[model samples]
Target: MKFTKLTSSVLAGATLLSIMAPTASFAATSKAGSADAKTNDNGGTKLPQNDHTEVGISFGDNNSNGNTGYLRLQAVPHTLDFGNHKLLDDSKLDFTADGKNTSLSVNNTKGSFNGTNANQTTTLATGTDTALDTVKGTAWATVVDKQVTRIDPMNGPEDTSDPTNPKPTSGFHKGTDSVAGTWTLSVQATSPLTAVDNGDPSKEIVDENGAKEEIKDAKLTFSDTQYAQTQNVLGLTKDKNDNTYAKDLADLTKQPTVAPVKEITKNVSTPLVANGSDITVAKAAAGEGQGANVFGWLPENIKLTMPAGAAVSNAIYKANLTWTLNSTVA
Candidate 1:
């Protein structure tokens, strides 16, 4: 490939960056278990037993149910350094909330690793502190002179109106005029339900319930952040003063705020199936690890919608989510 002087310089810079790029890697692991079992009041060293016992031999079915959630999402941290070496705006961009392992286990099912997932979402309330005191935020984000760039076509006959590349779906907004505003953030979603009330079983029919009762204590918080961490892979490069910085591309790709222009939600619900066999295990003597995999590949749909708003620098708004279970234990 041929390279002009400018292209060569850019390519050389990129290659140099590739070699000296600094990477930040972190690793963490955890294990935890909790059971809502019975306990004796006396200071007695006594053991309990399960109700389900094998013929004469008394085989105790065990259950070691647990979930170990792990989240390893990378973020890009930006630092706004003041001339005195003080940081003005340090932003930590949590681009993703990666993994949340929800699980259950029974003894005989030790080899089986399966789980059911219930969503928990909170409705964004009407009144929120969306108003950022820009005057006081001079340290976080100084309002530089906003410019209106008519990103029409370059070096071509342009028209104020065109079909294919029409005005922005976000609206034909000018620079500063569209930049600042009284942005109102609202939570919007659709919840669907279906049921088989007073079902007929004689004709081989199964009963049904609409939507599961949603869980409680959902929350949404909004705030501005500064000083985000960076992720680099090769662990080589450094800034001008040889200060290394790592920026993770994978993390940046996970932010909900950055969902593409063509994405949309459709509300739908999947039916839960309850298999026949039921085991009777006493709560007092329930051994370690004894549960079957109930949750299969079932997808429930949730439709979402909201109005567009301006995103100021070093600002972030988070929505805590939750959902109700069918309570059917199916």
Candidate 2:
């Protein structure tokens, strides 16, 4: 019985050893690296990056809305006043206005460097001052004396005649181009000016001598005149001054004073301020730097054309002007 018991115990012990050996082997492999072990990694790798952008532009009354550029325009004296004056017979008076006396200024900081357009222009128009007695025509007229000539300040003597020699107005019209473009300044009168006594064209007026007399048919005119700044590129040649003073005022009769006189045309007369004529006042080309005092004036002149026997009146006569500024890229 004892021998059988011993044999049974030995076989059981051997079976237990076999199970323990397998467990120990698994524990050792999990805790340490094996030279025979091979790693197969199947995966993807990534890298990073950045981006880009830009903006746009425009011009006008409102310029603060995120645009890339802008332009601004203004008239110095909002109102231009030609004070009261007494009209005399036979004797002619020289009446003119320009940047020195009457001025229009332009201020531009435009950053639109896209085109070759570096040009700007200013113009004028006139209207009847009163609505009381409607006159048949404009109260004022401009005429450049045909026989006169513009005297260059840098060259010589000023013409001493009425509607004196055309010259640059004192320090009035001036401009500077930060961008690239040309600027043209122009003017016109578009008012129907009429003379009347208590609004009646046939009323009589008391003269300085206290004589009540009929007002003669007066002539008002704008002399067709043009003047230009001397341009001397490369100091190559003599600077040519504007010779408009030497030219004749377009015959008011030939060039009807009822239409705008913009450009000089053969029979197309530049009418009174009532007619919208694009009169050239000043100009600045690209690269001309800042132009100062480029000037032109529409001198209004009145003449008693009717014979000495017209009836006159004792009343205040007035006229109004509508000056316009037109701009374009050249």
lDDT of 1 by residue, 1-330 (tens): 555888999999999999998997974321111122233222232334246756654111111112111111111111111011111121321111111211211111111111113222211111222222221122111111101111223324445486777544333333212111111111222221111122321122123653332212221112222111112212211122112111222223332121111111111222212221122110111111111101111111121111123222221112222221111111
lDDT against true structure, model 1: 0.20
Residue-level lDDT for 184 in candidate 2: 46
Best candidate per lDDT, number? 2
Regions of candidate 2 where Cα sits further than 4 Å from its true position: 1-73, 76-87, 93-180, 195-271, 289-312
Clashes of 2: 63
For 74-152, candidate 2 gives per-residue lDDT tens digits of 2211222222223323332222222111121121112111111321112222123222112112122112111111122
Each candidate structure's TM-score, on Cα atoms with residue i matched to residue i, is 0.16, 0.27
**Residue 319, candidate 1: alpha-carbon lDDT:** 23
C-alpha lDDT of residue 249 in model 1: 24
All models, RMSD in angstroms: 35.0, 29.3
